[model samples]
Target: MTHVVGEACIGCKYTDCVALCPVECFHEGPNFLVINPDVCIDCGVCVAECPVEAIFDEKDLPEAQREYVELNLRLAQSWPLITGSKEPMPEADAWAEKSSKREYLVEMV
Candidate 1:
């Protein structure tokens, strides 16, 4: 079991979760974060740290966000691991309440 980072993280990219991740399972994309399933211990520590409420347990992912299970796995393979907290995207606040930001997710840096 692993956690998945969903669309709510697309534009926000909040790093609070990173600081609390004991395994450094989070990967950083240009505008998003993904949890590496292979590395995640499924402790669920990152879930609450996310301001956008984007992190979900693999088994608990919303039906609409179910695709994120695979999305997180695929992206984590290419993105760099994030082990420390950092500032969120400049427009994080503006993008926080928006629900359909999947289209804004940047796969590359």
Candidate 2:
């Protein structure tokens, strides 16, 4: 199964996971990072690097976090993969500082 990024990652869109991803399966959203389940090799490398412990194996994810798995895969289907690192993007802390636990809002979208 694939790993999912949970509510804890909201706004804390750290690129550490993205950087460690071998297939470049991780994608960026307006406020967080999502994994492309179709492309993910399930290496678990990105999960280890997440400072917020937001990543989870699909089967291990909490019931509340389940939607994130679909969100990741849904987002992956249409979003482009990142090929290179950029400069001075929003830091995890910066995003975290302003992030709200908005998992419920995702359903409204």
Candidate 3:
């Protein structure tokens, strides 16, 4: 299983999680960050570093954010790994607020 990024991280896109990630499982996406489940060591460092409290253990994820479990993996596969500091994607705030109503919350995996 992998940790998931929830809605709170939408506009924030804090890289603290990325910095603390031991395996660098976090990847940059078009509008948000994704976690590579295959690469995640489950060290839980990223989870703690997230300022918005968007990260969650797969098994402990709330139902509202359950889609993020798959979203993380799918987005990570196609998106590139962003090393060093990352800038938050533009319009992340708008996306985050609407993600709950998005037709495709999680890309098909």
Candidate 4:
């Protein structure tokens, strides 16, 4: 199975995980990042690097965040692939500990 990027990444948009993704499975949106399930190598390298702890193994995804599994898959198809690290959103630190950020997600660049 693949890894999933959940709501914890919505506004944070930290790219720490992107740099370590061996398979280049990461996709970047205006305010979030997603893992392309079809391409992910399940290397688990991205998980520990994610400062916000947003990455999760598919089987271990929290019940409340299960929808993120599909969200990542669908959005990855359109968001540009991100193979390198980039700056986090300006409010990243502030949003890192915030919850229920699903509504703040931006699907476009």
**All candidates' TM-scores?**
0.97, 0.79, 0.77, 0.97
Clash count of each predicted structure: 0, 0, 0, 0
Q: Write the per-residue lDDT of candidate 1 for residues 1-109, one digit (tens) a residue.
A: 8899999998888999999999999999999999999999999989998988999988889899988999999999999888999899999998998988878888886
Pick the winner on lDDT between candidates 2 and 4.
4
| Residue ranges of candidate 4 with Cα displaced over 4 Å | none
Off-target runs (Cα >4 Å) in candidate 1 are: none
Provide the global lDDT of candidate 2 against the true structure. 0.72
Worst 10 residues of 3 by lDDT: 100-109
Model 3 per-residue lDDT tens digits across residues 1-109: 7687776675456677887777878877544677888988877888877756778889988887787777787788888886656655576556445545434343332
lDDT tens digits, residues 1-109, model 2?
8888888877566667887777888776666667888888888988888778889988989886677878888876665566545432356576555544774233221
Name model 2 segments beyond 4 Å from true.
84-91, 94-100, 103-109
**What order do candidates take by lDDT, descending?**
4, 1, 2, 3
- Stretches of candidate 3 off by over 4 Å are 87-109
Best by lDDT: 4
- Residue pairs with colliding backbones in model 1 are none
In order, candidate lDDTs are: 0.91, 0.72, 0.71, 0.92
Cα-lDDT of candidate 4: 0.92
Evaluated against the true structure, the overall lDDT of model 1 is 0.91
